[model samples]
Target chain A: MEELIQQLKEQIIEVLNLEDVTPADIDNDAPLFGEGLGLDSIDALELIVMMEKEYGIKLKNPAEGKEIFKSINVMAQYVNEHRTK
Target chain B: MTHLGKIVITPRGVELNSQVYPTSQIGDALLTACYRSCHADYPKFFKMDPLCRLGFIASELLLQSQDEERFIPREDRAVVLASCNGCLHTDRHYASTIHAGDNYFPSPAVFVYTLPNIVTGEIAIRNKYLGESSMYIVEDGLTEEELVQRLAELTFQDPVTTSAIIGWVDYHDGDHYNAILYLIQK
Candidate 1:
């Protein structure tokens, strides 16, 4: 679980091009959108694509992302269970 | 028949308002070096594709010394830009993502910049200009006569358009780009 979370942090930073942000700066339980990461709609779409590319997890519905991508911890948990590759 | 400002950026270096900028500190990546030389603080610039970045930087240099309120109204200024390659480099990069059979992964970040007109949108958004904005993909770079003809047509077509930012910005492969922008007033 800890390893997955750390990996998620690194992937997020790379995909989003968060040039100045470090993996340690992202709190596991903090929100990934709105106030926490200040990410916009485009960033959300990027995250969705990242999910499919990195993990073999295909989110059938965009609505499912709202729950799964709420935080780093949530995303890590979801990927661990659903990833086929 | 008035000229406000002019800027020309090439792989060699940058020329702002007819004077060549010193290239002592500028290294291989001329675009990034020029952006840093301008001392622009806009973070969104980092996320833009090379074509958009070139257009944005050219527009910024042209409008930097002018008073927007007194000279050109936000709603009356038009952005008329032309490009040759028209985001071909970004398209190639995005295509690479889905090329492999087992590693098929399309990137949304790169896909968003596939359109040629997005560079015009970036300029409009940055300057808060609500006026006309258009991009033309020409086979070769537009000649001065062709650019003037287009500008004349735009000015005549839109009664509200009294000022325009006209230029040619082209980016190909990697590290090969050129942008020449002119601010003209009727």
Candidate 2:
């Protein structure tokens, strides 16, 4: 889980073009949107694409994104369980 | 309309109201250097394409010359930008992404900036501007003075707009990009 979370952080930073951010900057449980990382709607879409491209986890429902992308910890846990690749 | 201030950015250097920023480094680093010179804190600036970067930096410097904060929200202001190339640079980048093969993922970040007018949108979002704004791909070989006149006419056409950051923001590559913005107010 720790390894996956760190990997997710790096991937998110690269995918979102968050140039100044590092894996250490993002807290494991901090919110990815609104208050924590301040990611907007476009960023959310990019994250979705990143998940599919990297993890082979096709998010069938759009609503599931909110739960899956809550944070690096939640995202890593979800991907670990559901990712086919 | 009355001219409040003006900013000129080019490969040579950046000039705001005759105050020249030293040409420390040119090309890709120039825009970042300009942003850093202002000591401004807008993280989204890094994500913008070169065209948007030129416009954003020009507008920021233009506003600063008038002793105004670039991020202040206002409804009476507008942005009228004209570009010669009109995002061909980014179009080439977006095209590279959709190539049919094992790699066919088009980046939404780069896709959002495919239009020339997206610069206005980015500027609007940054400043919370709820006023008239537009982007034009100018066909005429107008001189700098002529462009100022053309932009002034566009801004004046929108009666609701009391002021505007109007100019040409052209960027094709690291070697070729220029933005000259004038803050004009009624």
Candidate 3:
């Protein structure tokens, strides 16, 4: 779980091109949107694509993103459970 | 058109009303470095394309003085941006993302900035400007006076326009980005 969380942080940073942020900078429990990372709607869409491209987790409903991308930990768990590649 | 303030940004650095702000990061880091030097707090700058980033930084620097005026949701304020390349770099990159049939992954973050006028939108969003906003793609030899003239025509044509932000912001390549912005008032 810890490894997955850390890997998720790195992947998010790389995919989102958060140039100033590092894996260590992102808290496991911090929200990925609105507060914490303060990402916007576009970032949510990017994350949706990242989930499908990187983990094979195709999100058909855009509303589910709020919960799935709530935090690094949540995303890590989701990826671990759903990733096909 | 009464010019309120002018800001020029190049790979060399920035010049606001003839005041120089030199930067050490000349090539890829010029825009980010300029953004930092201006103490701009907008984090979305990191997500913007080269064209939008160049224009966003210039607008921030150009209107930094009008701190109070910029924050207010002014309906009479306008933004006009000109570029030679006009988001060409981003369009090429975005095109590449979807070009392949097998590996097509066109992200909205990248695709949203595939237009030159998005710079005008970014400036409007940041400054809460509800007035006229537009962009123009011109030849390489478009003069500074001519850029201002284009904006002046709009300012006069619109009855509600009391102030405007105008500039030529272009990013042709990593080493050839430039933004010349002006804040104008009647």
Best by DockQ: 3
User: Local distance difference test, per candidate?
Assistant: 0.81, 0.84, 0.86
Q: What TM-score results for chain B when candidate 3 is compared with the true chain B?
A: 0.94
lDDT of 1 by residue, B1-186 (tens): 577888897777778899987654332366666667677777667778889888888887778787555334378888888888999989999999989988877888899999999999988887777788889888785576677567657654788887878878888845578888888887
Ranked by TM-score from best down, the candidates are 3, 2, 1
Candidate 1: which docking quality band? medium
Off by over 4 Å in 3: none
Error of 3 at B165 (Å): 0.9
In candidate 1, residue A62 scores what lDDT? 79
Candidate 3 chain A: worst-modelled 10 consecutive residues by lDDT: A11-20
TM-score of chain B of each: 0.89, 0.93, 0.94
Candidate 1's C-alpha lDDT?
0.81
Show the lowest summed lDDT stretch of 10 residues, model 1 chain A: A34-43
Better of 2 and 3 by TM-score: 3
Can you write out model 3's per-residue Cα lDDT over A1-85, one digit (the tens) per residue?
Answer: 9988877788888777787788889988888887877788888899999898888899999999999998888888888888999
Model 3 per-residue lDDT at B120: 96
Off by over 4 Å in 2: B66-72
Q: Cα miss at A20, model 1 (Å)? A: 2.7
